[model samples]
Target: MSTSRFSSYQPFFFALVLAFGVFIGVMLGPIMGSKPTPTQARSTYTRMDSILAYIDNRYVDSINTDSLLDVMITNYLNDPATIDSFFKFLDPHSNYIHKEDLQGFNEDLEGNFDGIGIEFNILNDTILVVTALSGGPSEKLGIQSGDQIIRIDDTLVAGIGVTNQQVMSMLRGKKGTVVEVDIKRRGENELIPFRITRDVIPVHSVDVAYMIDDITGYIKVNKFSANTPYEFADAVIKLNSRGMKQLILDLRSNPGGYLQGAVSLADQFIPGKELIVYTEGRAVGRTEERSGKAGLFEQGKLIVLVNEGSASASEILAGALQDNHRATIVGRRSFGKGLVQEVYPLPDTSAVRLTIARYYTPSGKSIQRSYANGTDAYYDEYMQIVMNGDADSVNGRKA
Candidate 1:
């Protein structure tokens, strides 16, 4: 009888063990069978596996798409003109900067660079020196304006297919470096060769700042760059020390730069906690920037000058002061680039500047004209205005 009971309980014990095994499998199934992460999956394939497979399976006589595509992309990105067209497709102000161009871009924003310091223009395939920047290495070495670069070092560059890029590359260099150039002066029988030691050249956004009279001062901002606000502040302090009680801030033809610089500059004039500018986009929520910090010349009579060439951060500063009635806005209509751009650097050191937001004035005015007609048509709007006799108007109305 006991042996029979034991045999019957054996089936029950087997059933219990099976049930526990199934439950444990169900609990740990996801952890055991989960997909591997991207890093782990990449370990399974060698770097050249795809390229090798394409080479082996491709039926064409000769078509290296893998390497060809890389070369095409690199070439397109390297060419500034081509990359400019790519960005201009979306908007007028959007831009791309290759690694080679980053140095110049940084120098522009920083408002300083090490170079021989002469602005030149390639007119009729000849490099014409427009101006030997005052107090620069070139100017110090007696290099004058209207001089032509006939040769650079040993290369005969005159009348060659020498581009502006080549000329700049040959001239600009590290501090204490020397660049030898042959200048063709007017009425000179022979070319003049001079070795110019490169030095720090200041790129001034505040082109000129001085007291016009006892109480009146003038400051011209060529562009709103990273160093603009500090330069402006210093200029204002100097003017104030000279008994400047009224100020004229000129922004005519200013293309604009770092928005923070504009904000800081506007803050120097606008008083209290008033709204300066606001930005919003599809992915980004509405953000409002207000004026703070004790303004340097808040109590003085402020006049801001803007024109059709003034854009981006220029519009922001002007709009802020105009909306608050803090300053008198003079000159023609602004360029109206209310779009904000954010730059993202790629792994290869190249960068893409993308329009991420639309900024508005404190009074909820956009001032962004229109980009619906495409980039070409959009830029041509200025020509249309000029032809229509509307460009001469002040405050965007008939003069």
Candidate 2:
């Protein structure tokens, strides 16, 4: 299931998906707490009995209903073009990212990929930069944080229906490739054209790590991604080398990644037997992850920072640390996405990342946000609030 070359980086993009809100579907449904033992397997035999018996004993047609259903399902997902077309007819938020589209989608999730490395928000037909990586082509070419991206190559980037994917498709390519982009800065009306060479950029998981002061080392981690635990270990070692006796871990914007990755990272700071988080759903019974082995930094004064974006794996780490009193958590309430999503690869190279169940912090607080009004409305309610208050985020969420 770990799709990358490096085992350490296996959890890389999994956590970032939760932030894009697309993972509401990707990280989408029910947990079976109990695994199917031999007896359970025997119990499952009856599930297919009626259908198999019908195929063998009754039915008017060829009686290949089960096989026919399997073929239909396979063919449906194998056709990416048809799926994309189908998505075009659906709500804008309901998107279908093909295997090819997956790369670009992942790029958006991690904040970096093979490209110019700039985050842009479409505004009034103008592609405006939300932020630019300092070493990226956009930054190298003097593209400021708020610069307007007017055109990519010869294509004008502004206008209705311009998607985030289109911008990347135009700008991203194999290394050494060059793409022409025109910019309209806020201070000037003149359009400035710059040629940007595409390159492989490393997406960072450690958002902020610095000395809180002389003795306290503070590191804000967005998620437990591929190489996260190892990275945390290395960071800890480096800080220890620098004579840090206390640590502050910040998981403010994290949306969660691999459950194992969170576990691995949490293991570095927790010791003895302790419940991090537990899951239960319609199909599954109860599953709990207990701390194993002593953490490497168990002797330090530790604190964790959290906020609304924190969920899932983030909650696991926070909950585990808090449950055991391994660290102190300070911040606003987390997003409460305590459900788990398991990724299953289909025959077509496509996948179904389905939510398994409701995960709980040790104190039994459900980290899953209220999504009862259907997924679409549930997802867009935030934007609706912002719009209603004329771009006031706090006011809208407060409303």
Candidate 3:
């Protein structure tokens, strides 16, 4: 009877010990050699990752993640409160370029785009064709300058406060695609209709190059694009053949483009290994650009034309020439933009043009205007200058 009772208590004791051992293993699993499960490891995710995951898994409604990310990035970049503390001030030029606008933005600097190829401007609620680009479909179809576009396809576009973007969307399409437009010519009572097939159109940086006088040549540069150097070289060659001993490079109302384009243009005017421009930044450090190779117009009497509208690469060219004493700076004071921007492409094919450095002329003068008061105030100052007719003055004298 004693042995049977002992055996029953022994089974109970053994069962109790097994249960205790199991509990100890469970408690020490994390602290010991046991690896974390997938769910446990997920808890170590970053705050942004956690938020995104929660939105993806627990949100009430479904959403397009791509579009959501785009909006979020755009909003964050535009919001002043979300700016990083390291940046003391906000730069208006440092901007986010949407994926949709990326192609057009690149094409502008690339000096080519697929379109019917007509330069236009909206004036008095009418889309006026400034000029049908040379060798373009519109030019081939007798679409001349000063012609008004009253209709695009079946849509009446004239006198409707139509924007330049709207007109471009209506006209521009893929190569070999046809776009229809109705024109209202200057002396015609009837509207002329034309179907133009779009193609790769060359964007000319040098607007016009002609002999102004017996010894003076005038070249109006609209922008400094990839094709600028070539266009400028061609213009110089033509002008030189026409007995041009002096040159008037018109940079009036010219908004700048690529930095390399400006440096190339400056090299044409300034001979020897003279410092054209130098850029300095906290991250990028000092980068000096000097004139290289024999230039086309190095021996000519050069005159650079600038105004309040001239900025960036335009300012760079003008500043280099003025500082080197290679050219006389005419017109009003230039639009003081000396900031250098570098484009960084994102994974989504969008891009950011960030102000990476501040450029200076050879004399080491920074022409960038103060923007400590904010972008609105900065632009307002320029508007004030315009209103006061200071933009029209040149060298302390009225034009």
Q: Write the per-residue lDDT of candidate 1 for residues 79-145, one digit (tens) a residue.
A: 7687677566466657887776566766667757778887665655777675566568888888865
| Poorly placed runs, candidate 3 (over 4 Å) | 1-89, 116-167, 174-200, 379-399
Could you tell me every candidate's TM-score relative to the true structure?
Answer: 0.66, 0.66, 0.64
lDDT at residue 325 of model 2 (Cα atoms): 82
Q: Distance (Å) between predicted and true CA of 244, model 1?
A: 1.4
Q: Tell me how many clashing residue pairs each candidate has.
A: 0, 16, 0
Q: Pick the winner on lDDT between candidates 1 and 2.
A: 1
Best first by lDDT, ranked: 3, 1, 2
lDDT score, residue 72, model 2?
50
Better model by TM-score: candidate 1 vs candidate 3: 1
lDDT score for residue 85 of model 3: 22
Global lDDT of each candidate: 0.74, 0.63, 0.75
What lDDT would candidate 3 get against the real structure?
Answer: 0.75
Q: TM-score order of candidates, best first?
A: 1, 2, 3
Spell out the clash pairs found in candidate 1: none
Better of 1 and 3 by lDDT: 3
What is the TM-score (0 to 1) of candidate 3?
A: 0.64
